[model samples]
Target: MSTATPPVSGKLFGLFCLASYLLSLSYGSTFLLSLLISSRGGNEHDAGSVISAAMLSTFAAVIVSGHLSDLLGAARSVALFGVLLVAASLGFALTPGFGHLLLLFGLLLGLGWGVFYTLGPIIVASLVTPTQRAKYFALLSGSMMTGIGSGPLLGRAASAFGYPVTAAFYLAALASLIGVLLFWRLDRQLKQAAVQTTAVSRISWRSAGQVLSSKAVFPIIMVGLGGCVFGGLSSFQTSYAAARSLDYSLFFLGFMSAAISGRMLIAGFVVKRDPFRASCLLSGLMLASIVMFGFVVDSGFTYLLAAVMLGVGYGLTYSVINGLAANEAPNGTTAQSLLLFSLSYFIGVFGFPLLAGKIIVEQGMGTLLLTVLAVASLNWLITVGRLIWRRLSTTRALQRA
Candidate 1:
């Protein structure tokens, strides 16, 4: 790989990471918008509907935007999405009515978020050697975590200062704009570097279908099943803490910090070795963690242990699956494969929360957790089964020889 393919400069890549962090910060503010809705005579139903809408938009955008990124070029696509993000953030700050917030937060912001995830990896892929991909992916994932972890804290601070909840949106808009400016500068720098670039294939329905149904892409999607397990945990951790008389903040702190650390520290090793084995091991840990959450209710120590276990497990899972997917990108179809990976991931992220929420209401936490356990256990079983089958086939071939 040439040294000048757009992402070589440490400063430019750092800026890209900053942009990712800011985009996620804006996304995190959406979690605090229920208060704004309540102040306007709206209810949790409205908030749920808005959130569901955003998830739907995010799903659709990931599918379409990846193809669009291929056609329009990564720099242009990212620029367009960044502009939409700026507009959405401003709308969030200025829109007073619940309906408008739905449009801005649900549809527009979701579009921007989808585009950001789709392009970030594709751009990074173009910039680095194959060996370095996993490390950078780990770094970008950490950047996103930084934004997610910090956004809520900032929202709390704004409330402490007697600022209306809308202030969070304003701050998000400012951060987003700064991120956009940095992206624009990076785009200019890429052009100035004069790297050889390939022309992306024009997208068609047939081409999209072929990419989606390709064998290389299937494992990538399967890897994303872990996200369903994670979404369930994220959606109910606060309630779980309350039920057990534990501190929600402390539980989350352990979970998110451990997840971030695992991605940064353990992901490189996983990607360098057998990703399937890593997947099986980490998923077993996730299953164990969920079991702890369900049955162990004695002390805060259990909460800490479960959260950290879950975090480290899923964190490594996230990085390994992404690195594996990126490795499968054939020539001009990198964006499309990544889109599938993101789509499968968000399906779990969005779908499982709703599923788990309903199950919790109808049955109980015990049943909901059992459901998570079943899904996670199945994931581990499939990976382990594949590994065993591969080893058996290799041994048979050796005997024949």
Candidate 2:
């Protein structure tokens, strides 16, 4: 029940980062689940459905795991989900054909992702001083981005060597298992050091309600919008590339490269100063990138350019929003606020693909891009609006005084 922040340890932080990277690599490898569905005779709709199912499962998992973390402790909760993730990856590799079973595996995969993704930030928040959180958060995100970005390239390499794409799933399983072990070690170290984790003592509807209505709502909404843009683009990049006679890997390469660099080098400095204004600028960049991708990206060079812009824009924007969510959280409700943040983001990331699949099937990729562009525009507008509102509110309060 103590509210004091735990003392940071350099060794434990490194272990957490390594585990996060490996776990993210496992999740990122599955980004190509659409290809797996195709190989098994499933179509776009089927792929979308499976992905959405996983996302919804993630949504549920975030809520459930938040409570479980409080009860069982962060390390145990993470390990349990990590085991589920490993099992799901193995199942994807070994499953004979795509069917309802694939949906089941997807759900399992999502459940694992929800836990790790939510808890990773909580652990970092506990480890770092408030003044250092922005840098550390960006660094943590950079580690995750590096792993995620590498996953698709690994799949591409396997394909280049004429290995079955499914072979990547086996690698994913291995990465996840390693992540679990790393977390286990981290837990032991924390216990030995007697580091107090950020886990809350209890969760309740009243606290959840307060978090929902708190300033955290702004970041939650922004992240959800960003999630929609990310989900729509990443989930369907393969199809879009094929339609344009481009390699899908280019998108991942450019996006991950820019995103990683920005998080590592740029995000901490800019975002920590004025997160709201930074979000607005980055959101504008994201909108421009989407516009270029949707309307002007004909050559591979242009495609990569758009992807890079998106990487800078959305990637940095996400980190800023994440920090905002944590900083703006009401006292005693950081865990719940972050839980909602994860849930909102999952909804957009996993939910949009279902609609996007339908749009691609009926209206084509052009329509899909336009829709995503619209979402990007809306996200930017919201960012700008929130910043303006906050300034006005501050000015009015001073006037009243």
Candidate 3:
């Protein structure tokens, strides 16, 4: 890897981390504001819907924007996305009514995030090689963890600052705006003629299908959903903590800090030894964390335990899944794969949570959690079964040859 790539010099990478940090911090703190809606008297579905709306909308936009970045180039797409994010933040600040404005903000923010979500990783990948990916990925993931962890602290800051509960939304928007400026600077550096670059194109559905038909990529996708399990679990931690009377903000901080540490601090160790085995091992760990979460009743220590377990799971699953996504990027399929990966992840993050919300409503949070555990086990089982089949087929082919 060339030292001159993105000039990780003098807070260049720090700025990239800052951009991501704001994205997560702003989004995570939304939970606090969501609680306000409930305090003012909203239903479970109402809050869930608002959260889901933001994720779902962002999910849709990211898939589209990510592919465009490949066709258009990471720097250009990033700067463009930054501009949209500022616009969306302003829109969010201006929306007056409940549900109505919430939905509109959701759309605008989603658009901004979609562009970013797509471009963030893509740009990072463009900067580093596969061997160096885990470290960079971990650093970026760590920033997100910090942002998530800061949710409660930021909420407290919001209060002391004498801002409205909705003020957190504007603050998040502000952070993202700052990120835009940082990314614009980075973009200028990346576009220079002196920087050696590789050209890549968007993957078409036909080619993507061909990649999917491959023995390795297909299995990776199913196994890849393990990444989503961590995502789904994180989605519910706020309610789980609050039900136990834990400070919602604190719960976020603890959970996020652990996860951030896992990614930023611990991920390199796992990646250094073996990215493939690390990935497989993380899947097993995620299953274990969910099982523990299913049975634990007292949160005094349970939340911390669960957070650590979940953090490890997230760090493991994401570290590998991200590498796999990068590896699976067929010669010209970078954007297409990114789009599809975002779509798959969003489905897991947004769609699974919506489904789980129903389970929470009918059976209760505990039951919903048990269901998540079952889903994790089941998802893992399916992956194992596929891998077993693939191994056997490979053995047979070798014998014939």
Candidate 4:
């Protein structure tokens, strides 16, 4: 056989997509954990804290995983995260009390997810050119969304066996293991084929600083800010549905389905054309979703529409942002650049919900919705300002020339 690496065929790419889906299926518990905590006598605030804790831990892990990705290589780092997921899952299955669940569910699960999120895209980016990046990214994102959509259903089904909450974790662990194996096999095949992948001797604060200083930093921050709404929705959407007397699962289905449709059908075209424009649209949609939630008064149809809008907006936004960050990755520093992107993501995920949890406890979901809407609107305005600034600069340069 030729020593050259085999080209990534459509079939191989499809399998990778499948791997993405399986990996994401593990996230179904993200929505369930809050309810689990609440059911076990932890109040809504405490349940929100669990999500906040997990996201905060994820933020920390993404920062560390950047360096780890450089040292260990993307494939090995991903496998390591998978191992963490397995351990965390087993821990969740066996934990006897709330404190233990916090560690297992909040910390370890966050680490696993953080690494998986950090490296999976780098792996895919390595396999494609800058031009093909957005499309492939959308596919991977769509796959993950598919998994996220199915995760709750999986957890619900697994719960039928016994110990419903624990069963969800157990099932997630099993599914995560399968995903790891699939990814590992793909990695081995790529290595055997001698395909080049991201590798570096060391990464540190210095490298991260370099990325922070780059032009991409502003857009990355905008993308991350958009996630604040996502963080709020993740922690509260189910409860919000409950308050409105809408079916939680049904609402999520509409949301996830819209998100998937946006990614698979619409993201490629919009992101490829102008990521910034897509980001603006996504932020606007998020703001609208929050507005719908804030004003909801027993209209199931209105609630479902809001969910769908949130899903489509977030779905398209994430794919575009990831693609933008990937495009900005300076030679051999792909992982570090991506880490910056991940950091931005979890900042919103960690900060917004934590603060909103407090607001929800004190003021109510209405106040929380207003907060998200305000932040989202600000983010959109910032993106639009960036676009205008770039245009004005280009115009000035032309005049000077």
Q: Model 2 clash pairs? A: none
Top model number, TM-score:
2
lDDT scores in order: 0.70, 0.82, 0.62, 0.73
lDDT per residue (tens digit) for residues 1-401 in model 3: 46325444536677778877776655555455445555556545555565566666766576467456656666567666666556654554455544656666655555666566666666666666656665776787678667656755665677778976666667766876676676666775555421224454354569568567644364346433653465455556656767787644544555576677788667777777654456556667778878776777466667666667767776556766666666665665554565666556555655565566566667788887777777677656654665677689899999999
Per-residue lDDT of candidate 1, residues 188-290 (tens digit): 5654542334355234566557666664464565656786887666655545655677765555577778877887777766778787788778878887888
lDDT of candidate 1 vs native? 0.70
lDDT by residue (24-93, candidate 4, tens digit) is 7666566766566666666557756766677767876786776676676666777778777777766755
Write down the worst ten-residue block by lDDT for model 4: 1-10
**Regions more than 4 Å wrong, model 1:** 1-7, 33-47, 70-72, 86-104, 156-169, 191-198, 201-205, 212-215, 329-332
Per-prediction TM-score to the true structure, in the order listed: 0.84, 0.94, 0.84, 0.89
Ranking 3 against 4 by lDDT, winner: 4
Clashes of 3: 1
Error of 4 at 129 (Å): 0.7
Backbone clashes under 3 angstroms, per model: 0, 0, 1, 1
Each prediction's RMSD over C-alphas, in Å, is: 3.6, 2.8, 3.5, 3.5
